[model samples]
Target: MIPDHNNRDAAATPPDALRVVPVEPSLHRALLRLRVRPAQRDRVGSMADLLADVTQCPGSEPMAIMRGDAPIGYYRIDASARSVAGRDFAQPARGLRSLFVDADWQGRGLGARAVALLLEDLAVRHPATRLLVLTVDCDNRAATRIYQRAGFVDGGARYHGGRCGPQQLLLRALP
Candidate 1:
């Protein structure tokens, strides 16, 4: 079992065994056990709610970030721009949504690792996708930094459609 720690050290690196994979039946129970901290509830919402959103929305692909056979985080890639950015994208883009690390796994840099892998995975999975779009809440500076580090560029535009408040629409071109 992974040890629980409350301190979040951004510089920490993720384990080498980490892999981002689609959420399948065998991993469903483990993914359901993952949760973000209480303070992050509004930003990412509860796992149950996110799962429900994936189910109700067509073209939404739910993925799990795993270490061996255990899930450490979760996210979704939505083909519909409206479902992710709440607006039409200028080009062929996939929306990255509902990304979050489990509360027990927060400080380990797994989020960044998952993103790097996800981007690589996207190129192969979506050969025609020219861009990847996502909206980060304005107040979520940490998340913004992580995305920025992963090469997501911000255009200084605010998306006011988020449940918490205004969000920055960040974009990155996919290979």
Candidate 2:
């Protein structure tokens, strides 16, 4: 099992205490199925496709949260020079491209734990990286709260048109 070094309280512990691990392509299909809401099924699938592409792309590495041998969620950490949320963060900086916990695993702190694990890994492996960024749907209050508690600050917002809701950019600066 991967070590839980994030200081996660037991009350906030994820069901089964999922351990975050390096994601493998073989688990991609399974990780794609993990989502908190049925309405987001298509979006989640698209995210999986993006993740697969990133995993194959040079200079990118992905990680997943797992329980025993089952994938519960996944996130990609990009080290390449790219702009997210209209801001050009430097290379070696990390961006949380996608993160989703299984519906059955919601409200147990699994999402928070997964993010904490990713940030911890980034801090060690890429100490010089200055920023960690992510985008959230404006309507996703729960996720916003989690991010806020995790030290992410609101950086900016982007309109995606229609009722899909605006996207809010959040960031956590690394020392």
| Among all candidates shown, the one with the greatest TM-score | 1
lDDT of 1 by residue, 1-175 (tens): 3321211332253554676777776777788899889888989887778788888988999988877658889999999767666677777988999898899988888888888988887877788998888999999998988999999999567888788899998998877
Q: After superposition, how far is residue 150 of candidate 1 from its true place, in Å?
A: 0.6
- Please give each candidate's TM-score: 0.87, 0.76
Q: Counting only residues 3 or more apart in sequence or on different chains, how many pairs clash (N, Cα, C under 3 Å) in candidate 2?
A: 0
lDDT of 2 at 152: 96
lDDT of 2 by residue, 56-89 (tens): 7676776777775688777677664354454576
Weakest 10 consecutive residues, lDDT, candidate 1?
Answer: 2-11
* Model 2, runs deviating above 4 Å: 1-16, 46-48, 55-57, 90-92, 159-163
Residue 48 CA displacement from its true place in model 1, Å: 1.5
Question: Could you tell me which residue pairs clash in candidate 2?
Answer: none
